[model samples]
Target chain A: MKIRTSEYIITEVFHSLKRNSWMAFASVGTVAVSLFVFGMFLIIVMNMNRMAVSLESQVEISVYLEDRLTDSEIKAIDKKINEMNGVNSVTFTDKIKALDIFKERLGDQKFLLDAIEGENPLPNSFTVKVVNPSLVKTTAIAINDFEGVETVKYGQDVVEHLFDITRLIRLFGIVLMILLAGATLFIISNTIRLTVFARRTEVAIMKYVGATDWFIRWPFMLEGIVLGAMGGTVAFIALRIAYNMIVAKIYDTIAFFPLIPTYPFMTYISIIIVCCGIVIGAVGSVISLKRFLKA
Target chain B: MIEMKDISKVYENGVVALDHINVSIDKGEFVFIVGASGAGKSTFIRLLFREVLPSSGALIVNGQDVVNMEHGDVPYLRRGLGVIFQDFRLLPDKTVFENVAFAMQVIEAPRRRIQHSVNSVLDIVGLREKYSCFPSQLSGGEQQRVAIARAIVNSPALVIADEPTGNLDPDTSWEIMDIFKKINGGGTTIVMATHDKEIVDIMKKRVIAIEDGHIVRDEAQGAYGYEN
Candidate 1:
């Protein structure tokens, strides 16, 4: 009689769940574990991408200047390099300034740099920041052909390898995430199928008594959705705590390393995990019930 | 009212379950369909409910062509009918009250109306005291009664019982027949398929006999008419 929609569905869902409590737990656990792994990979992939982008943007091409160049000629080279298509900025480092940086970098070896300080053989250099990392090699070659430039040294091998590795990591992460989602859907639905199969007679009776397809479907769908959302929520909370602890430990040990901070990123991670959980749960129920719905 | 014209059903495995059958069932009548094992009794009943569509010809139940009915409307068509099985397909997990109440819930009957109708029907079936008892707690006879209660709870114009007393003892079978008599008295058409000769001979209802996918006899107030 005029039953409230949610009340009826929730009662049915709870009844079915109670009848198949063990199977429900298994389904939820499967969804949770799969979702957890998927979520972990997503966060890793996101952070790695951020780190890669930051590193790429900071890639600088260093052009060591000849010691015999006049001041005006060096300035002209600076302007020319700056005017190149993809160069964002050009900063000049004179020989004395370069030696000072060398001394600072050597820390305990400052006395060795002091022996050659007056007769410094270090060359002046122009450090160039490129707008796009993929064009760094071309920009470096163009700058090398400049009249006064002695050598164009840009950690070429290391930078190219870093870009390649980051690209591969991103592609691998996407493929792995898709596979994990497919696997999660399969496991969740199979688990749900066990429960649905057990109660098939009830479903048949409902059909026999004139219950609409949706009327029969609502309870099972609700059960799947509730289980999935719960699994996702549990995984999200666990990830948050684990991520925070790990980040705290890492930051404590390595203060200068860049990481996407816990607070904002976790907020996004929670949304993604919960959404996936609900969608996967609904999809699983639908897939499992396909045979039964024919009647 | 129910009518069938040239209805035929052929299974995928080459078994001809129902072959070119035609029959009509009038309103407010009690008819018994009696047959031997594998005599197409089950297929005939299944055709009425649209559970298995006939391979050919028209089936009109309640003025709608079941053969051409939309898949979505099958459930609605079923709402006008009450069906009971030999095994008393009750939800073992639910109590008697919930079992009967589930029928009304499926049709979206109001809450108070469901409670009222379920209680009244349970009283009719003499299961008022066992409202909270699960199917496992009830005897075979009582479980069949509960199944009857569930079927009739929605007050359909037609009740189709397929061997409603198949699992009950003769004495209990009489008790189930008494309930069917009471329901028929209320002006509801009933088509029952059974092999219970003693009950069929005593009730003196109109009997239609089928053998090997064909109707052999159709008589008024006939006996079971089988020597075996």
Candidate 2:
């Protein structure tokens, strides 16, 4: 097709949209709202995962050394623990230092300190920060084999349960996105199908007139794309405004929650919304066109 | 040229619409396919356009084996022919100019070419003044003229009119026939399917008569042969 004619087709498509502005707007509005919900949920799930990771980082593993270890042996074990996979950092806390910190906490409890006597019962230890808190078991196992290490003391049950919760959340979040994507496709396709059905005669006549399939298809495809993108833009704007409002209201109460990534996440979702809108609109137009183009 | 060699069409219910219809028309010939309702005239014309496939036999239009034509080539093939309907089938919402321009738009005719061609055809149909008029705004005859203008604007090799005057008064029908004659005079072959006996007789063109899904007569300068 000539470039000029292609422009005319686009003109016709946009003109049709204007003529049916109310209907077009309604359809686009639905797409925007649906995608907004999907995008908002996505940001929420991502932030929640971030929060979980932050909380997990605070739980450190302490590896106690056996009393018989020489300075060289302790140094060798420290090096091994630090070199282990998933161990982020290792700091040696000498037995005397650990007792001094305990005493500082129990300032008026001289009797309690006396019960422990002058002899320090605490073992010298290395506090380990794991790069991945979810891999605590693996890190504990690696440390357990160290020659002078007495025990790897991370709260096993709590870490395992927390890890399981994060995994479940991530899985459910993915499944939800998949289901919502499918729903968006379905709704957009049905909407375009109705538009195609309403203008089946136009499509039939265009075909009979010897119009190329693409020539006929371009306008409808453009219409779909426009609808999707408009919807996505509206949704993105609504989400941004809504997120800002919610964040402002809950800032103090939710101090433990990480700072909102509203701007960056909005940018990411805008890209997704535009892409999804275009894809869905094209798909919808294609489905509706398939049956009507037989002429 | 258009030719149908022993073409037959049978619906799935075993009702035959056309039975072994063998016919041919040379380029520039103006012929009439005259038959009563359900006599298979529509089916015969529809076959040439590949709108309906012949259940058996070969149908060729301008050397293309339309009977075996692939689905993708149908539109390209149709671009070489124009099909007009009895109901005038102009989009009511579009102005007369838009209706004519639609033909060129489908073929991706450039804006300048489409504008030039639509104006020229509208002039030929003597409706240049009604360019902005919608189908509903025009009279029955005027709307049919717009339909004819759309059909012929592309300078197609063939123009198929199915009961072109079926919905018009005798006076308006005659006006439409004059427009068809003018188009035929321009060297485009014309095939019209109609039940208007008086008009067919007056035109005195070659008439192919069909009855009960079969061609009953083929005569040069013939009249509508059968009476109701």
Off by over 4 Å in 2: A55-59, A71-76, A83-86, A96-121, A133-139, A153-162
Q: What's the CA error at residue B171 for candidate 1, in Å?
A: 2.0
- Give the lowest summed-lDDT range of ten residues in model 1 chain A: A1-10
TM-score, model 2 to reference: 0.90
On a 0 to 100 scale, what is the lDDT of residue B212 in model 2?
A: 87
Task: Encode model 1's per-residue lDDT on B45-116: one tens digit a residue.
Answer: 988899999999889998888999999999989999999999999998889999999998888888899999
- Candidate 2 lDDT, tens digit per residue, A245-276? 87777786886568556778778867987788
Those runs of model 1 whose alpha carbons end farther than 4 Å from true positions after fitting are A1-3, A62-90, A95-125, A130-164, A244-257
lDDT minimum window of 10 residues, candidate 2 chain A: A252-261
Give the C-alpha miss distance for residue A88 in model 1, angstroms: 6.4
Task: Give per-candidate clash totals.
Answer: 4, 0
Among these predictions, the greatest TM-score belongs to 2
